[model samples]
Target: MRMKHLAIVAALVLGLTSSAFAGQKIKIAGSTTILPIMQRVVEAYMKANPDVEIAVSGGGSSNGIKALLDGTTDIAMASRTMKDKEIKMAAEKGMNPKQVVIALDAVIPIVNKSNPVNDLTIDQLQAIYAGKVTNWKEVGGKDEGIVVVSRDTSSGTYETWSHFVMGKTRVFPGALLQASSGAVLQAVAKNPRAISYDGIGYVDNSVKPLTVNGVEGNATTAKDKSFPVARTLQVYVDGSVSGAAKGLIDFILSPEGQNIVEEAGFIKL
Candidate 1:
């Protein structure tokens, strides 16, 4: 009888081990701005749930949404909400895209640390990007020509900057365009005359984040909507996601997952 009981226990242990090793693959692709946060979150989640496997990649927000519509990625991470046209496309394709807000982000205008200019009003920012204000001296900086570095048209960051700063005015045709937030940061960090913007999490000491309209962008301001460029970070899953996809989204919305957001330098929900 004792031998029989021991055999049953061993079988149970083996079954548990087998299930734990069975893989549930989840693919995430999207906004480079949210990439750092998701990377850390994926690391923690995978450690806690060894049965699940997750893959994450960044190709800008527009491409991420496109991947979801094409039935490629399980989750689409974005720094901006999906456009009406994108929703229409999803509807026509029989795809039900559900958005889950994960965090709050402040779009910060950054410049080289060596630059003396610290704060910029909305009007000043608009004029600078519009090619109306051509020199730094015009906006309280040194007597040097301003080099405008902007995100490419496909970027969600570019869309946010356009809505909040540019209004109807278009970016200067002469401006330099980068493909990602990291690229914009690098471009500005390497050029004293260059100015650009990015999500708050991507801002580092290499570049100085200027105060917009005398208000600093941070967790508090972003959360309260006091910052001029505050926006929500999100993930879009097709239809009603179940299994590992749902688990991952739930984990991101959990307290511990939100801690990861704060650690990643964004405002947690």
Candidate 2:
């Protein structure tokens, strides 16, 4: 009878473990620029499919990809493409990352709303960020020192800016480095002499967007590839993800999800 009881208890333990494993919640992380959009998408998804559960958070594009590689997150949101080194590392770990494009974006320059400067040529922007142009007057603005605010190295926005805007140069050491897009927005909004760059979605009445080479960073311009800094917003997954994770990815690519992307101030794919 003692042996019979032991068998029953083992069966119960196995059942409980299987149940818990099957019910694990889907986790999404990375890219503060994509966090707001994912939050809204998650809300809509959960409301429609009440049985599923998902958790979303932001660190930055690099951290998100790292989370995926470490098996901590099911989805990794990124504003920039994964670097070759990252891909090689994932391959070495036997994880093949699949990229999915969800939306389009423009990494546009921004300044305090009170600033008079409206447009900047790419050459002038390079000079300012390279620490060559110290005063706003050099770029057609007031004669005040330009306070440069930049996203930190881990940020996908910063990657985009470095590749497209800074080119062969780098942001000067004196520039203030912000951790997230929201932080960058707030830093520029609070300081009249400050200038920064962020995904177009983060722009609000609190800060003014600057045109590049006389072309604006709007949906039309981004879609047509005329926006110089425009890039595809994407997510990365390891191997073939199914169940709740795949469901969430499908929702993001669906028409309804794309609509939410546009509503969140990004261009729909």
Candidate 3:
């Protein structure tokens, strides 16, 4: 009787261990813009719930959407809304992408600190990027030729800029394109004449952020919609989210998760 009792206890322990190890794991991939906020929130979530596992990555927003349609990632991060074409493509693949707005963001234009230009009107910005105004002197800056830096076409930041600043016009062909927001910051900071745009969270002492039509890019301006370059930051889930995926999403929308967003230098929703 003693030996049979010990065997039952051992079996119970093994079953509990198996169940704990079987907890759901979620994978999130996309927008470099949303990477920092997601990282901090997920780190907190994992600590609070030890059984859940989450993986996060950044390869621009478009790639994140592609991952969702391909059935590779549980969540897709985006700085801009899904284009109609992307929605259609996902439908063709039988995948429905649902967006959850997690925060607000303002795309701030940045220039090297040494540059004297402080603000730019909408038309002036358009002319400069359209290749019509090639020299800084035209815009009350130095006499040197302007060094245009921009995000790659695949980037959601680029799409936002193109819509608001460029009026859907293409950036000048001569502009240099960077792969990520960090890359854009680095390129602009290193070159005195270089001008580029990045999320407000990415703004730091390395580069000077320019005012758009005299309105600064910040939480206040973004929330009031006074900032011309503001947009929503989102995470796209496949159909109805459940399990670990839903847990993470719920935590993000909670007050605790929104606090993480603010702590990461973004405007919390």
In order, what lDDT does every prediction score? 0.93, 0.91, 0.91
Which candidate tops TM-score?
Answer: 1
Model 3 over residues 187-248: C-alpha lDDT tens digits? 99999999999998899999999999999999999999999999999999989988777878
lDDT per residue for candidate 2 within 1-269, as digits (tens), equals 99999999999886654343355588899999999889999998776556667889899999999999999999999999999999999999999999999999998999999999999988898898999999999888998999999999999999999898899898999999999999999999999999999898889889999999999999999999898999999999999988777777888899999999989999898
Better of 1 and 2 by TM-score: 1
- What is the TM-score of each predicted model, taking all chains together? 0.92, 0.91, 0.91
Positional deviation of residue 18's Cα in model 3 after best superposition, in angstroms: 14
In terms of lDDT, which candidate is strongest?
1
The count of backbone overlaps in candidate 3 is: 0
Candidate 3: lDDT of 201?
85
CA lDDT of 153 in candidate 1? 85
